[model samples]
Target: MSFQDWEITFEERTEELVEDYGDSWRLKFDDNIEPDNPAQDWFQYIRGAFARFQCSKCKKTWPSRRVLVVFHFRLDGRKRKGTVEARRFRQECRRCQEAKMEEPQFDSDNIEVLLEKLVERIRMRCYRETLDGIQRDFRPVGRSEGPHESSHCEACLKGVCRKAE
Candidate 1:
């Protein structure tokens, strides 16, 4: 919801997607209706970003670049169409005793990087295409020092993140 103010405009995302999936590719904000299950053709991947978080109770703000977001996508080769679903992860305020899992906030730069990596994954997984360069890591342009706080991460708490694994 808060990501509506993303610095990366929709046009930029569309252009990036069009370059890979062609002009018929569509980006939809998934409502997550049915389930997390992906069909046979659907490919699932994880995208991480440096997300900012503000505690509602304590009003404490912090930056974390390891926020894990899940994505499900598929490309219909015959139709030359594609669909993507993004699910943002949340984190709790470590300082607040009754803290709720707050949605992570991302900047334009992070969004741009995330989308680029996502499209790359789509190209490889769905289209079975190989890239010339080495595979890139999800390193967003931001600074968040110290070890990752698994205690505050919703994915870690739910045993879904790599740390939890």
Candidate 2:
């Protein structure tokens, strides 16, 4: 998938989450997920999706299906309120001699797919739904060549992203 406006995708996914989970859950995108939340049932989920990125200086474009995304959420059953925070990993242009870590650009389809899995995870974790019969397909729209470079990935640098076991 090519680049699309992340803000719009986030808003759309949030609306879907609200529609499915009702008004009790509040989802937000943050720079980082705070670890000091007082919620006892706080949980975390990590997902990967294919995204396109371009070097700001060199204009070099590349595709990566290893772009990692992290979600932290908690459901306060007593108050019937839930909170979720998300953060997406970034990558630097490998071709550039000196490049900044660029934000991943996700197309509408990829974003939808990613958020769909997120909703499923929420149902399994917060809603206590079993994952036995859930569909686990999270394959991206296109294939990315070469192996993922942890050296250029922001999440990898911070030890937030991990290889699939």
By lDDT, the best candidate is 2
- Model 1 lDDT per residue over 1-165, tens place: 344544234346557557755645555565352234666778787756677888999998888877877778877777877777777778998888989998887766667667767766876886677867455454443567767888888777667776433
Query: How well does each candidate superpose onto the true structure, as a TM-score?
Result: 0.74, 0.75
lDDT of each: 0.69, 0.71
By TM-score, how accurate is candidate 1?
A: 0.74
**Superposed Cα deviation of residue 131, candidate 1 (Å):** 1.3
**For candidate 1, which ten residues in a row score worst on lDDT?**
1-10
Clashing pairs in 1: 50-65
Once fitted onto the true fold, the runs of candidate 2 whose alpha carbons sit more than 4 angstroms away are 1-22, 34-40, 131-143
lDDT of 2 by residue, 1-165 (tens): 332354455456557546766646655667666333423557877777778888999998888877887778777777767677777788999888879999888767777777767766777887777766445455464667688788888877887666563
Off by over 4 Å in 1: 5-23, 29-37, 133-143
What is candidate 2's CA lDDT for residue 3? 29
